[model samples]
Target: MTTSTQIQRLAIVTGASTGIGRATAVRLAADGFHVLAGVRKRSDGDRIASSRIEPIILDVTNDEHIAALVERVAQDPAGRPLSVLVNNAGVAVNAPVEVLSLDDWRFQFDVSVFGQIALIRALLPTLLSTRGRVLNVTSVGGRVAMANFGAYSAAKFAMEAVSDSLRREVEPFGVAVVKITPGAVSTNLTESGLAAAARVTDTMTPEQRRRYAELSRAFIAQAEGFARDGVSPEHAAAVISKAVNARRPKTRYTIGRDGAMFTFMPRIVSDRLLDAMLRSQNKSLAQEKR
Candidate 1:
């Protein structure tokens, strides 16, 4: 028989196969939440589940999957109002605006923007029923621009705007929208992003290629450095968990040292100065690749 303490809150976490999403799902399960881990692949879903975490096949890009997940959660015996919805599934495609293919641009926007919005729309009814919390996992890139990451930054910026609007709109309904931005957490995204950068640059004009090559390499190197310095996914999960449980959760939570610095520095520094600083970083990165 399951004890009251064992009676878990129901949470649906997208992108639970790896990185922050996986960590959040696991941590929530450990915290006595019956986690519905969402992954694109069945294999990844299976990998996400254990005695505590229950995996669910979810492809954010698929409408059927999102609808099916909502129905499944609604039918749970726990009938517990969906306590949390963590929108953590996202992809990064780093390329210069000129060189980036339309498909690549749309792909990033689809997963990070359209898909995320769709999931929230599908689940908003459940969240409203339970007066639950919605956590949008944004990135520090959303707040500031980075060369070679225009596509990713654009999507994130749009997501942040979406989150801000939703936060205000949902407050009266007692559903809180929280935005958590992490600077860099050791994850495969950097490696994959670098690989995509290489692929995109291959089709670029010689001058465009020459300009982006060093910049891209430097960007990758920086990403690698971030991965090395980044806190574990578990650490990010813990911080998120606290936000979920807090009596008065803040609208925004910035994770990691770099995240905090980038988030707050803008208030103290002039925009032009900040732009110069960022440009300088890019220039230095380019030089390093030479």
Candidate 2:
């Protein structure tokens, strides 16, 4: 009989160019899984490739890339069973619902929601065969939608629902679906989000700008603060690793104190109270910029 030690395990992590995805890829490789690290550019793939971590070009929004990834998994030279799929590729485009273009909203959902689901559909067969785990790197935004974050938050909220539905659908089949909800981490998201926010602000009408410009700045400041005070990608990776390795993992795993708080805060607090709290915090952040 083949011992568990003798069987090689394969894990795939998307958006592995940097931050949490990169960290998780490295962590899983260290844990003895042969990792397929997904990156958008060839240079990035080259940068992250290792003996145990093979970098693959994967733009989650691209169907051809998705097909290629499925093929790669099917043709693993070592015949290892795929044990984990980390749906970590996501982009945040933050703007007021009225100000953000329909195209922008669709783009956010395209990468964060549809792309994630597409990959899962492609790999569900292999995952089912191996009784593998699916780890979705979602955000606290899913639970608490904040002002000026409607597009990004909506996508996360959708994924949260998807995660719940998927867990129920797959759990009985021996496939584990875990949501890795992170509040904030010192990643490039803040910088990218700020840039996107600036572009959106430029497109706003003068009336719209007058209404939301300061609020947008406040949101930007808050994002920067989150990045400055947030946990490291390695810490997020450790949390994710725990979820991946657990024999019977919880349906959801929150990464930080903020994650835990915001996730459950909605359950305990009334919407009116939550709104007041968010308003107060945004006001404080806006003042700090003065």
Candidate 3:
């Protein structure tokens, strides 16, 4: 028979204002878990809060907020271990390596890599005590890089590495670290990232722009297309919920068909073949424009 402890779980999800994070927060609450929906803004938090889900203002980049969250988790009356920590907060900046500014690159890293690490470190004590699970929401771009997504891919690659190392480090303590690589989901990230990309592109010298025009357009179009064809955030959230609740979850979970097929399949194929295939796809998109 399942005990009360087994039925009641506490889940903390970062970036819970919208998209995957928001969806996951709602789903976890519905699954009988008390959810701490972390958002950077109070308004965003307010939008996510409900009877089951409680909104908490958390900017992963802010040390003070992270510390507060740790304290709050430590004070839970049930003394039930934190069942899940879903690190779904990330930012994307799309631009060719040459045109991508240091600030833009840093911005992506700050949110996706450094911010995530900061939050994990701050909550390590509580997580260790509880033997909870940590889920890092990476991206397929981490495994396979596209031309214009260099900045974003670099951050995700670092996140993937961090997640893998953390998984090994905490295993002895009964804590599980899972890397969730999502391909494409309908979210504001693409539109916002594309705008940032455009700003970076505008700052490029005429010569640089001329040299990279086609690649730039192709990248923007790809981002837009992905946003359009992306799966629902709810679908992705369900996968995350499973990862948290499963008796024996895998080390890594890939969400979306493209992530499972194209992203994972390239690992088995030759690098040259993969490059050629990507080049062909981009070329086709360019030709369609002309």
Model 2 per-residue lDDT tens digits across residues 1-290 = 22354249899999999999999998888777889999999998888899989999999999999999999999989889899999999998999999999999999999999999999999999999999999998999999999998999999999999999999999999999999999889899888998999888889999998898668768978988978999999999999888888879998999889999999999999999999999999888888776
- What lDDT does the true structure give each of the candidates? 0.86, 0.91, 0.86
Residue pairs that clash (backbone atoms under 3 angstroms), model 3: none
Question: Which candidate achieves the best TM-score against the true structure?
Answer: 2
Candidate 1's error at 137, in angstroms? 0.3
Candidate 1, 23-140: lDDT as tens digits: 9998888777888999878889777778778888888999999889989888987666588999999998988888899999999999999999999999998888888999999999
Tell me the number of clashing residue pairs for each predicted model: 0, 0, 0
**Cα RMSD to the true fold for all candidates:** 2.1, 2.1, 1.9
Best by lDDT: 2
Off by over 4 Å in 1: 1-6
How does residue 269 of candidate 3 score in lDDT? 87
How do all models score by TM-score? 0.95, 0.97, 0.95
